[model samples]
Target chain A: MELTLHVWRQKNGQDSGKMVTYKARDVAPESSFLEMLDQVNEDLIKQNDEPIAFDHDCREGICGSCSMMINGKAHGGRKGTTTCQLHMRSFKDGEQIYIEPWRAKAFPVVKDLVVDRGAFDRIISSGGFVSVNTGGVPDANAILISKQSADTAMDAAECIGCGACVAACKNASSMLFVAAKVSQFANLPQGQPERMQRVSNMVEQMDKEGFGNCTNYFECEAACPKQISVGFIANMNRDYLKASLLHQEPVGKA
Target chain B: MSWIVRLQKSSLGSKYIMAITGAGLFVFLIGHIAGNLLLYFGQEAMNAYALSLHHLPYGLLWVARGGLLVFALAHVFIAYRLSFHNRAARPQRYQYEATLQASFASRTMPYTGTLVLLFILFHLAQFTFHLVAYNGPYTDSLGRDDVYTMVVNAFQNPVYSVLYIISMLVIGFHLSHGLSSMWQSLGLNHQKYNLLFRKLSPLAGWVLCLAAASIPLAVLVGVIK
Candidate 1:
């Protein structure tokens, strides 16, 4: 099958980018979207040109490494699937696919179809982890979490740090992503020590990052491979509001 | 700290402001429509309505009007800034087509707002200030050329009534997303309120739309004349 690709190409973080059209031939209908890109890269190598760069690893989609904006969607037109999981069968023969990187002011383009998602990392570092000592594993029953709490925690923990939520949001807001990280710990007893601090600091960090605000589009949920609910966003909001209200800065108003 | 500065400068801040201002606007629209509803009774009744408002003690009227002005300015400023920022971030329309898959009102706020802004200006000129040179006769709250009666006489013109009705339809379009967006901005995240606001916003929007649109339709059709 033949495919017309409108692939974004950027030299580096400093340079502006443009969409370059490439005619890819002999694509296999059974091949995944990454496989089709591999074919195109091979052709580029034969022509002694720099292959279009993109991000993918563990092609199985669990690592949250495979990222691309196929057409207008975050991980292509398919729902609940990553780019590497999307197969050519989803596209018609002779189809034109628009591919680009995860876009947000925080996630600057590091290279073609690759963005610096370090903002998300900073958000996590601010408070995405439990304060349990890492010297040795604690007893399994040290904290007897209710079945419901454990289940809800697991649901929030399913987030893979992909920037799809930010990409899908009209404002490029990462509320869903930040909310998931906050909810995972805040829901469990192990995370109680830093619960208030975690929500406050992480939300502050998220704001420091260039991500936009959530506008209730629900596009983030629709685009998210894990389908993290917007409920967590509400939880984060409640916690943050409480924290800010209680811990007023000594100086000027927040 | 600079971190706080950076946070507020981000796109998220604009959306927050949008949601907050939108909520205030939604509340204001309801009151405005309710006030307009008096036109249904008769000229004397509507004029008394305006007179009642003017009779408020202290600086209350000035405060309300001042607050409204601030809200309108901030809302329009924030919306324009956000839209421009969104455009700059994209720099180009999507190569592939995408649909909103939402209500018609949800889809056209940006465009409808532009029209509504013009309509608002015309509205202020025609009725608020009596500066539009409209030949229609209007009786005031104290039985003078009050703006409320101008509202009635203007609606008597089918053309004016249709314009008002169409503009209200646009307002409905604006409200649909505006209300939800505001709830989100206020950070009202409890699932109970989330469901409550979702149900409440659309109903409120529809009520305002119906009430506002009904006035002109009634007068134009001679139901209220």
Candidate 2:
């Protein structure tokens, strides 16, 4: 199948980007979306032109590295599927595909189809962890956890930090991402010690990062490649409220 | 920064304000609708209810009104602030954005909320302040402010009835998203009950809208005369 692509191109973060058109000729229908882009890049290299730059690692979809707005949708409009997993057959012959980087103030364009998602890492660094000291590994069964709680925690833990939630949200909110991190810990027994502090610090970091607030639009759930639920956000909100109301110590101080 | 300042400055904190204030207002709406439904019980019953409210001890009526005013102001103020934050968060928008999960009510929250606010002001002016004249006399047999007569006379006018019904519908739309979203914002959500809230939120909105609209329609059609 042949396809016309309008891909956003930029020299660097400082460069003003614009949509540059390219044609993917004689592409196989079975080729993944990233593979199709690779084919296009190979052709560009032969002609001595700069290839389109995009982020992709572990094309199997777990890394959450491949981020792009294909046809104005995060991850090519496929629910629970990343760009690297999207196949060319999703489009028809001669179809025009518009590709752009994630359009959030937090995620700036790095180059063609690539945006710097370092903000996500910074948000995570703020408090997305358990501060438990490294001692002898405790018996897994020593701290008995209910199956339901464990499953809920695992569900929140599935978030890949892709920033697609921010890309898809009208407000560019990272509430879902932060919520997932907060919920993963909040739901577990081991995560209880600093639960309040964790929520407050992470939320403060998310705010400082210039992400928008969640208005319960549920777009993040729809656009999430990992199919993360917005319920985690509610959990995060609950934790933050408790922490804000009851805990007097500043986030980092505690 | 102080916690209060952080709460005020953070986007999520403002949403918490909206949720809390919206919940307070929701409670007021239920009470208001119940009182208005007294119109179905005839003029004496409605007037007695109004008199009872006015006669509450310790200046309770003023206190309740004052509380509602604060809730209204907080809800609207936080919402306005969040909207500005939302716009600034996304300076560049998608060329062809498509929504997959957000409802029509969810997308048009600001417009519906503003409409509801205007409707509330108009309602208060017409009924509470008597700034707008009713088509007929408002006095009851006991020389009290005949709440039922005022409502019936106002609805008897085609223009007022239609406007009332339309405004109620807009309020319904606002409540459809607002009620359940308040739950999520306040972290009252649970996996077991989240679906229930989502389904019931809109149902509650429809119930309020229809119940409120029914009074005007009934009055307009001479069912309550």
Candidate 3:
């Protein structure tokens, strides 16, 4: 199949980017979206032209590294499918595909179809962890967590940190991402000790990173590749409210 | 740090402020609509309801009005703050923007809210302050303030009724998103109640706005003279 591609091109972060058109000829329908791009790049290299640059570590989609807005949609608007997993057959013959990077102040464009998502890492480092002694591995059954709670935790843990939620949100709010990170622990026994502090610290970091607030539109859930639920956001909101208001620990301890 | 200061600084805190104030305003809307429905019961009943509100002791009516003003101001103020913050978050927009899930009402909250606020100001001028051309220090047969006649005279004008009906539609549009948003912002979501909670916004929005609009429609049709 032949396809026309409008890809974003940028020299560096300092250089303002623009869309550049390219042609993908002799592309196989069975080939993945990334493979089609690779073929296009190979042709560009043979012609002594700059190739489009994007991020993709694991083509399997678990690494959440392959981030791009295809046709103005995160991960090509496929249900639970990443760009690397999307096939060329998803489009018709001779279709024009518009590919761009995620748009967010927190996620700046690094190059063609690549945006920096280091803000997510900062949010995680702030509180997205459980403090535990490294003396020994505890028995999994020792905690005696309910099956329902375990299921909730596991569901929330499916988040891949792809920043699609940020990209799709009109406000560019990372609430859904932060909510997933917060809820994965909030639903478990081991997450009990630092529940209050975790939400407070992580939320503070998220605010400092200049992400917008969630207005309950649920756009993040729709864009999420892992199909993360907005219920986590409500859990985070509940926990944050309690943490900030009712559970204020003493000055030095907190 | 004080929780008050903390609430002022955080994003979730901002949502809480909006939810709490929005919930208050929503309750006031319910009461306002309920009171206005008295117009359907004839002029005497409507005038009596107005008189009862005026007869409250210790200037309680004034206190209620003041509280509503505070809620409206806070709701609008935080809305602006959040809008600016949201706009700044996406300094550069997508060239080919597409919305997959957000409703028309959810996306247009600020515009609808601004329209509602303007309507409220105009409504106050026309009715509450009696500053419009139909100003009435009117007295009924019982020597009471004839609020019923004032309302009837106002809605009888085709221009006034049309403006009122349009304003009601806008208010309904605003509440369709806002009522549901309040529950989520307050951390009140559950799987069992989620469906009901989601339906509550649009259902309540239409019901309340239509109920309020009914009075003007009835007056225009000469049913409440």
Candidate 4:
């Protein structure tokens, strides 16, 4: 199969980018989208030109490092699939695919098709952890978590921290990502110690990171590679509301 | 930060304000529509209802009016601020954009909301304040402010009726997305009931729009005099 690609090319963080077109001839249908891009970059390298820069690691869709918008839909518009897992077969023989980096105030473009997602890390660092000092790993059966609670927590834990939700959101909100992280911990017995503090701190950091608010558009859910539900967002909202409304300072140094 | 400041400054907190104020306004709409439906009964019934509202015992009318005014202001102010924040969140525009899950009503909320705000102002000017002139007297048989006659006369004008109908439809568009969203924002959503809310949002929107539009349409067609 042959395809036409309109890829954004920027030299650096300070450079303004524009779409540049290229033709990929004799591409195999079984090749993943990143493999196809690799073929294109290989050709560019032969001509002594700078290859297009895009982020990818596992190529198995779990790393969440591969991020790009294909034809304006996040993760190539597939359901529950990441960009690395997207196959060339999803496209027609003579299709024109436009690829660009995730666009958000918090996730700025570092180069062509590569964005700096450090904001996500900062948000997680703010509160997304359990700080309890368990000397050794406790017995798994000691917790006695209910089946329903376990399943729900796992569902929320499936979030890969990819910024596709932010990219696809019309408001560029990171509510889904933040919600998944909060809900994963909020549902477990071990997470109860810092539950209120976790929600309050994460939400404050999310706001400080300059992400927009969720207005229930549901675009983030559709664009999510994990297909994470927006219901977690409501849970996060509930937790945040409770924490803010009924908060008492912990008995410690002020 | 203080909780009050956080509620005003944080995105999630402001959404709570929007949800609470929107719910308050929605309640007012339901009451307003039920009262206005009295117009179909007869002039006496509608006029009596208006008189009762005017003669509420302990200044309750002013209290209700004041509460509604506050709710309307908060809803509009928070919505305006959120929209501007949303626009700034994505400084760059997509070259080719496509929406996969959002409905037409969901996508056009800000536009419809602004139109409905203007309609509200116009509606109050024509009816409540008597700022807009109509070719009729403003008194009924009991020498009260004749709301029934004023409403009918205003609707009799073809231009006014058409504008009112259009504005009602726009209100429907806004409510289609706003009602269910208020539920989600308030944390009332459930996995089992989420689909129900999505379906019901548009149904409620259209029902309210049709009910509001019926009065003007009835007047225009000479069905109500």
Best by lDDT: 3
Tens-digit per-residue lDDT, B38-111, candidate 1: 87777777777787788788978898899888888878877776666554443334455343233455545567
Model 2 lDDT per residue over A105-172, tens place:
88888787788888888877888888877889888799989999999999999999888999999899
Tell me the TM-score of each prediction against the true structure: 0.87, 0.93, 0.96, 0.97
Least accurate 10 contiguous residues by lDDT in model 3 chain B: B128-137
For candidate 4, write residues A32-107 as lDDT tens digits: 9999999999999998889999999999999899999999999988999999999999999999999989999989
Give Cα-based local distance difference scores for all models: 0.78, 0.88, 0.91, 0.90
- Proportion of true inter-chain contacts also present in candidate 2: 0.74
Model 4 chain B is weakest, by summed lDDT over 10 consecutive residues, at: B128-137
Which scores higher on lDDT, 3 or 4? 3
> Best to worst by TM-score, what's the order?
4, 3, 2, 1
lDDT by residue for model 2 over B42-95, one digit each (tens)?
A: 989999999999999999999999999989998988888888888888888876
Candidate 3 per-residue lDDT, tens place, B1-225, comes to 567887766899999999999989989999888998998898888989999999999999999999999999999999999999999999988887787788999999889989999999999988888787575778999999998888888888889998999999999999999889888998889989987679966798789999888888888888877
Chain B TM-score by candidate, in order shown: 0.88, 0.95, 0.95, 0.95
- State how far residue B83 of model 3 sits from its true place (Å): 0.4
Worst 10 residues of 2 chain A by lDDT: A245-254
Q: How should the candidates be ordered by lDDT, best one leading?
A: 3, 4, 2, 1
Which CAPRI level is candidate 1? acceptable
